[model samples]
Target: MMKITVALLFGGKSTEHEVSLQSAKNIINAIDKEKYELTLIGIDKRGQWFLCDQEDFLINGDSPKDIMLKHKGLAVAFQMGKDSEQLICFAEKTFTKSIDVVFPILHGTYGEDGTVQGLLTLANIPFVGPSPLGSGIGMDKDVAKRLLRDAGIPVAKSLTYHQWEQPGINFEAVVEQLGLPVFVKPASLGSSVGISKVKQQDELFAAIKEAFAFDHKIIIEECIEGQEIECAILGNEIPIASAVGAIIPQQEFYSYAAKYIDDQGAAIQIPADIPKEIAALVQELAIKAFQVLCCEGMARVDFFLTKEHNVLINEINTIPGFTKISMYPKLWGISGISYTDLIDRLIQLALERNIKDKSIRKSY
Candidate 1:
């Protein structure tokens, strides 16, 4: 059997760039070497792509923090050919090689928000994760909530405001509707990067400003008091949802620090201590959200479960974090799928979708 040449793309011009590095490191370690000939491609903060080496990290087993995307001699790039994909390495000149598939581990913005997926779609290459349309909607909180609401999914009441529209009046009226202790977040980001928990009217404007710093559009959500839960979904047409997981955040919310940097962080309960019916509902909703959003390979659907047992869809993460301790993989692990096997399945799903896509005719 021929080893598949896989390009593992990571890092990007996003605030979550460092987190992406950590995620890519975990992915590189878990991918089966016998099945894939993996090449490391790093996109720096400036959005420049460079060829990176995985030898040091693989051989020494370095910590995720130590695993930086050091630029190698040549720059790596991808392009679409008539019938195949080309991953060319450039130095003085250039050399091209065929890439069988791409496993992008980049987490936010330029990487996960459909920018790379659109490129891969144009190249007609098999890649792990959702299609460009799915990725775009998944990354945008405003668009996603609207779609879910239309589909009869329960979503929290929220308001969207662009940075330019901040000057408009009616702050008091807005607070009156949503109530106090709202969530202010950037419309298109993850890992709680540009998010703030505003408990008072005085905190509202500052929180909005903070979120707008990361995205042109900012969203304020009415705080739903309940347990934070997440469900992992995999596959294409008939995706499988893992057992629900509960999050007990040490901080006010699941902030960036609690997720990654802090040691005490959050206590994640696998097979969340919810009723059987609620778990079943979450599983069903997870698949429904995945299908409605057009997610193909994988996604992690998060929810807020109220005391009265009402499950409200918070958001969906198309390419969620994959660090060794991340909830997405950990939840699946408890569901009896090993980390390595989960990665294998995602790659297989990518190829499966690619074959189906190729069957369609462009002219017809």
Candidate 2:
């Protein structure tokens, strides 16, 4: 049997580039070599793609702040080929590697916000994770919350503001509506990048300014007092949710540093110490949110479970972290699926989804 060729894409123009690097590294290490042939494709901060050598794909150091993509690999470009999409390396001697699928281990911005997904969709390539529409909906917190709320899913009260509307943002008015301790975050980012917890009136504008630096739009959400719960979702038409997990952050919140840099950032509890009934409800809501958002393949649905057992969704991460300590894989790991098997399942899901999509008549 011929092994499937998988182009593992990582690193990107997003602030979560380093996180993506770590995810790619872990995936490469855990992926079954006997079943899959891996091709490393690294995207730099400037958005250039390269055909990276698996052995020398990372540089600087392992620390999230210092880690960087080794750009020494041959620059590559994705183009439409006679049969399908082709990744061509531009060097003294040109090379082309046929890819059976793409595992884009990228997070945030261009990588996660449907740009890359759109490109792959147009190139007629099968990639892991959600479709382009799903990715877009998942990345934008403001849009996601609206959809979830409309579907009768509970979510924290929040306000969305674009960069142009900054001048008219009244801190006092916002406080009156949402109360103290609001979370200011870039609408389309993840891994806790450009997120700030503003507890005081004086801190609100500064937090908004910080969030605006990362994105054109920002969302200020009322701080929900509860446990930070996360559930992993898998499959397409009939997705299943894993056992609910909890995150006990050591810091004020799960900041970017705590998530990626700090070793003791947070304590993860598998099968969160909640009632079995609550766990079932969490799983139910998780699947509902996954379907409501049009997510397929996989996603990490985050929520806030209050003392009263009320669940409020935080956000949906289409390409959640796959790091050694990341919650997405860890939750599934505890739910009877090993890391390598989880990867296999995701690849199979992507292939299945692609076949289903192709069967749909494209011609009007």
Candidate 3:
């Protein structure tokens, strides 16, 4: 068996850069060493790519280093050959390699917002996760909600605003419709970054302004008075939805600090303590939403279930956080797929997608 040269792309010019690095470290540990010749490619928060030797996190006692170590930093660019049979990466003065497939273990902004996917698409290289179109739509919360609602999926009622748009115009109008106690989020961010819960009118404007700090587009959603649920979806043609899991956040809502920094901040309730019918519905909606948005490799669908048992699709994460403790992996683990196996399956799906994509002719 030939070993594939897999480039594990991690970190980026996004607020989730640290989270991405953490995910990449876990992924580097899980991939089967015999099948893949893995290379660690780290993109700094400034968007510069570096070829690193120490992909694993350095630990001394309980303290971990702030960033991964780099042995060599390369300024690299990819170009498609005339034949289209191979893709080339040119790095600085004297380094080049053919990428068999790109396992982009990246999250948010340039990494997950389809910018990197588009570049890989142009080079015709096989990469993991959803395609550029799917990723782009998934990153934009407003567009994702619209598509999910169109597909008969229930989504929380919300209003979207861009940072440049004038404020103080009809704040009451939106509040009156959706009511107080809403979720303010940056439309294109992930990992619970730049998300806030606004309960009073006085904090509404400030919440929106803070959300716009991360992304130009912001979504304000009516807070559902129920449980927070998440479902993991995987595959290409016929995707599989994992068992649903419930989140019990220590804070009022799942915040960045609660999600990562604090260990006792949340508890994962596997198979979600919901009725069987609701579990079935969550799985069904997970698959439907995955298909609705053209997600291929993988995604984690989050929802808000009200006291009345109303299931509102919250959002879809194309490149979800994948540490051993993340909901995406934990939910799937409860569904019987081990972490190592899930990583292997995602790589296989990437190869299969590459074969399928190459079958189409760009120039007739």
CA RMSD of all predictions:
1.9, 1.1, 2.3
What digit string (tens of lDDT, one per residue) describes model 1 on residues 12-35?
888887778888888888989998
| Candidate number with greatest TM-score | 2
* Pairs of colliding residues, candidate 3: none
lDDT of 1 at 144: 96
lDDT of 2 by residue, 1-364 (tens): 9999998989999989999998998999999999999989999999998888888778864666688888787898777632344788899998776788999999998989899999988777899999999999999999999999999999999999999999999988999999988999999999888899998988988998999999999999899998999999999999999999999999899888877878699988998999999999999999999999999999999999998899999999999998877999999999999999999999999999989988999799
Report model 2's TM-score to 2 decimal places.
Answer: 0.98
Per lDDT, the best of the predicted structures is 2
Question: Which ranking of candidates, highest lDDT first?
Answer: 2, 1, 3
What are the lDDT scores of the predictions, listed in order? Answer: 0.87, 0.91, 0.83
Error of 3 at 315 (Å): 0.5
Off by over 4 Å in 1: 57-67
lDDT of candidate 2? 0.91
lDDT of residue 261 for candidate 1: 61
Which of candidates 1 and 3 reaches a greater TM-score?
1
Estimate candidate 2's RMSD in Å.
1.1
